[model samples]
Target: GVLAQAIPARSHPPSARSPRMFAWPEKRGIASTVIRSADTWQARSPLIPHEAFRWLHSELRLALENFDPSVPGQEWQGKAMSEWLREYYLESIHHHHDAEEDVYNPWLAALGAEVPPSIASDHRELVATIEVCLGLAKSLVGGDASAASSLKRELAGMMDVLEVHFDMEDEYYSRVLVDFNVTQAEEGAAVGRINQDMGLEGCRVLLPMVVYAMYAWGGPEVVEQFKGNVPPPVWATLESDWLDDFFCNNLRVIRRLQGRAEPELAEGA
Candidate 1:
């Protein structure tokens, strides 16, 4: 009913007066489409992304603790710490905002929804914060001990902005999707397209970051949801390689600092 109302039926020639509309792309391949229809389709679950963000928030806090100068045996040095923050910023936060700006918001606008300008403004602010942190991080790369304290402060500020930005995004966009009755299949397709556009190399770096963060924080449901959407070949690569020793090692370090037990690195049958 919502789809029919939002999008008029196909006609001989597209009407000049017809409402601009959005639909899931049909070109991603039949297998993906079928999987989405059979396995992924459902009512929108806004909490999944929200949970992932919360996990990221927690991970950053843990990282900052490791970076603290007052802490005995500082676990993270300038270069390694900087790289970690860069990876999270680029693969997670930046990509997430870019997807909303380029795909999600535009799609809603085409569907005649009034997408809020504040969301874009929030992204800009977040980007500025990220850049500031990154610059501080770069300065730290030469083992500047003094920069550690400043880097930690910058990270804390970034976290503050992220908390508010994520809440706003979840409130507005998630509600819009639910209100419009956007199928999970459609949402999956949109996400799939965004990943595809990133190319294989980009996926190599980003996919694991996303999977690790979501799995570590969002629990089993989020893990299964993401795994189900991944094709078998890609899923195999993620398990066998991308999320291999390095990811597990990082997980171990983070968990140790937080006084948590080591989680099973791989999902079991």
Candidate 2:
């Protein structure tokens, strides 16, 4: 419900209506459609694009820690975490795919019919993998550690699948950027560019929010690898007001579930 509402249909409004000229290109007694590029006008926004990973990462880490032997809440906690994983599955990952489907796929399809089809097929495959993960999630909730572990093993198998998926996406984006001269715009350069480029921004934004979200959900090394990119001022800002808002508003939910609170901040927030 909350997740359903979280992903709005349009992050930004389109510039104009469809034109008959672009819609139906003419050849010698033949007609074709010219699919315009999926202009990522809102896609490149600062806060929202990164927010999904942040939310999912935090939630999933809490779920994993729920599996900890020392964790107090037991099956009850596991059940709650299971619900969260499912919510995140539907919200973060699924919603993201929908964006690709609606925007990226159509544009790529315009490039060639096969392109979108191949890309669309991956959605189904990912759904299948998620189904397996869901089964593991259920077992974990039911207190079936063995079953859950088996599912996790299978889920781990999909890591290669997922990585390849991301790789394909990166390739797709790279190609699109080249087409549009938007490689620089595709990713915000000059701002945390080094960390992301060299993979060092992790060190720059090492607050609990960044750590559990980017590192834990994605991978520890994803952030650890980015150890230097976060500029001092950015880090200072994150440490202060941004962090202050995150914890002040959300710490209780995370803490009650055995997550570390905002006990440590790099400096301020």
Candidate 3:
């Protein structure tokens, strides 16, 4: 599968008609009506990396420990998922930085908050490491057996930097919306801009990754609320199409590989 594509074990809410995600929503005017509870969803975008990075921190360390990539039939699925996950982790970091520098930071400044130079510094350091990890991932995904161990160790070392940057951004980057009382609609507009920036690739990739990865921290309802923020054509079937296809068909093996049990997905049950 392409690295450009990827959500939820909680259940797929039955849509009378499941929408296909062939295109993103056309850009349009956002209603100026103030949105209540916007800050939570506002924080959700940047915080995705916060949660995803933390989760990947452990999963990356566990990838090699749990399964042997060299085994052809026995461990192939695990090997593939591990490789896909590595790529997914890298994508999350890249998108997180894009959101921060392009959207989140300006809002922070608008609110009279200055993003510390160290945050960008940390990003440069993290992104540089991420580039190296992505290379390792490209090799591992390409079936280079040796790449797994190297990628694992690099990620382990990267965690110290990731955790520090996350905490720093919590104080400086993500929290600024609430700190300044940014309205939900206002924050939503910002998210829309991000959605616009993310455009097609984000629709196929980051959207599902965030929704599913979010389950680690926020669970199903959180996914629902987060869905409201996702602007649509994709949103119409975000769960039913992109998310389910990404998770159930593609990522289901990961649960088995990780030694966790998942219910068989019964459509319309």
Candidate 4:
């Protein structure tokens, strides 16, 4: 039941094959690369460009609110709530930061002969935080109530730190990286490497979930940018009829939680 248990619908697609891909195509002029063999299929790596980060920021903000216990179980369960936090904050978020450390930081370091101390310090801090969060996830999973409570507290602290961290990133991106004329091709190449490293199936599944979360947060402009950058083949399954319907419905639920369509902020929004 671990697999079937209360895992949140993956915010991005994971490596799994969805039935929707079988019938859906042409929805976005990105249907030519349909994955015919799920077994041999590999997934694309998740790379968050500057715009993608902003989109994620929006989505996470909404997700935290909606997943908070103040909202009812009819919306999203406690286990799923915890899983969502673990998946995004613990896994995805850390990986994204690691990407920066691996790729962008090195580039900066090479240019300057030394990486900025502030950035280095931030990376160390993030490493420490990720370690603590990994433990917290384990504790929560182990059913330690006191640990869970403490973990939640730490999680909240991490969230606060994350807001600032992401803010710093946004500032840096606008001030410095934006001037580099970083192209989608360059980023895509990096993403391709990451994806190949992650394997095709893994990439396929995770990218969609993260992409959806970004869209749920960043709105249409971000989505367009995402589509523009991602290879056409990577999205063949996601653009299918079933997934389209599914993702839309999922968005509505997210909106309800985040108070998107409402005249005012809805439930958690």
Candidate 5:
């Protein structure tokens, strides 16, 4: 696999405390567990905000970890990783920003509060930064070792911008959504529209990524929210097909890089 080729096995044995740190199957089960634990979908608050942030943070962290310039052979390895991250950034973060600007912002403006221009400007800047990173990644892939350092710098800059941007967007939007008395159904519908716009192929990739991020960073509340929001068949396909194949492999590489233990999957799952 691509991940296995990139990240070598750890020299030290897995410790009892962190037995499954890099364990993909165990983490995959977390999503299943979250779904199974939910008895109902009674909670009606919008989950898009929390889930978006979770996915953004988790994806960025994973990219940064792998993009670390100090890591040997990052020049070549980072090319593929960066390409993957670029696609994710576009499909998730960029898509989210577009949705906010196109749908949420206009809707809120109609309701009385116009979203700040600074947020839109931030999106533009972030888009440029992502392009720079992608360009650097392309250069690295073309055998330019020096481009690795530049790619790392761009990724760092992107992270800084995103941290501020995410906070600002969340605070501003949360307040507006509250003030406008937007219903959970409305939010869900908006997100559903956005997903539909993304098309089937996009969902095939993004859905699994979303689930993976939810498990990684969403904690209990977010997990419950995800379980509530997502349908059973959708969740099943994401878990069994997409996640088990795609995300789990990459996550295993990340765990190995972090020197985490690989936990064993449960008996049945």
Candidate 6:
């Protein structure tokens, strides 16, 4: 059985006296520990983050198509396209890349993982583009029904960047984390680092976004698996306001785009 411990606050040589800490945290601490094998990590592909990438890109495509045909449905069902981009799209991805840098990059680098330089460059370019679009989205307040073709074209460009970036990221994760035999403890640290950085405030939006993405692309089993990997409290939202406010409303825009039925918790995801 693996002896679990906290993630080290700083790196140290993996000597018997000083080594990297890797454990799933619990209320009483690492006193009673149980760790799954790499098989648990291997059961998934591109890991949890990549799952969100797939679903979010799918959502982006839906958004772009809906907006392309004249931006008609602004008021009835859910958020306006621009509003969704401002609140969710721009921020969600921006934070995702940031977390990868702050959380995953150090650990992966230490593990001798080979990451392509392009992924980091893609993240920077994508965030800059998204920030500019965020400002445009802000101006188009109320998901402005009269949004111009120029804005729509901006979204198309965003979708192009987003879609290509997703494939690149997925490839990177598969090559680095998946085939490289990342330990369950290491994976646990990655999850732990993500949860810690997101904190409760960030989780209010970001966690639900992850849950929604998992629910949409991966289904119930997949969503449950994803939920289990993170801190349990993130999903334990009182009344699930996170889902209704952060996830469902934006998802409704996608449904409205397709002329589909309004969202339930199921649809919201």
Please tell me which predicted candidate would have the highest lDDT against the true structure.
3
User: Which 10 residues in a row give candidate 3 its minimum summed lDDT?
Assistant: 29-38
lDDT of each: 0.58, 0.44, 0.59, 0.48, 0.55, 0.56
Candidate 1 wrong stretches, greater than 4 Å: 1-46, 69-76, 212-222, 253-269
Q: Report how far residue 104 has shifted in candidate 2, in Å.
A: 2.1
Candidate 4 accuracy as lDDT: 0.48
Model 5, 1-269: lDDT tens digits are 22212222332233333222223321232222112222322211223343444445554565556564446654446555555555655446666667777876776677688779998788788777766776876776566767877776777677767766765665566556667777767766766666666654555556655654555544556666776666555555454455553434444444443345643454444
* Residue 93 shift from truth in candidate 6, angstroms: 0.4
Q: What lDDT is reached at residue 269 by model 4?
A: 26
lDDT for each residue of candidate 3 in 82-192, tens digit (9 for 90 to 100): 556554557767877877788877766776876788877877888888889778767765677777668768877887777777766655544666677778788767666
Task: Supply the TM-score for candidate 1.
Answer: 0.70
- Candidate 3's C-alpha runs over 4 A off are 1-49, 70-83, 141-145, 256-269
Task: Report the C-alpha lDDT of model 2 over 11-89, residue by residue, as the tens digit.
Answer: 2333232111111111121010121222342222222224334354445455454454224545465565456455434
Cα lDDT tens digits for candidate 6, 1-269: 01112222222222221111111111121110121111344445443555455556666666566554333444432246666666666777788888777777767887888667887888888788877777667656554444545566776787677667766665566556666788777777776767676555555556565555544445566656666665434444512345545434555566676566655432222
- Model 2 segments more than 4 A misplaced: 1-77, 111-118, 180-263, 266-269
Best by the TM-score measure: 1
- Give the CA lDDT, 0 to 100, for residue 131 in model 2: 75
User: Which window of ten consecutive residues has the lowest lDDT sum in model 1?
Assistant: 17-26
Q: Higher lDDT: candidate 3 or 5?
A: 3
Better of 4 and 5 by lDDT: 5
**TM-score of candidate 6 to 2 decimals:** 0.69
Question: TM-score: which is higher, 4 or 5?
Answer: 5
Task: Give the poorly placed runs of model 5, Cα more than 4 Å off.
Answer: 1-76, 216-221, 256-269
For each candidate, give its TM-score against the true structure: 0.70, 0.46, 0.70, 0.58, 0.69, 0.69
Please list the residue runs of candidate 6 whose C-alpha ends up more than 4 Å from where it truly belongs after superposition: 1-47, 68-79, 142-147, 178-180, 246-248, 257-259, 264-269
Of candidate 2, the 10-residue stretch with the lowest lDDT total is: 23-32
- Give the alpha carbon lDDT tens digit for every residue of 185-216 in model 4: 55456555555544443443356555644444
RMSD of each: 14.2, 16.9, 9.2, 11.4, 9.8, 12.7
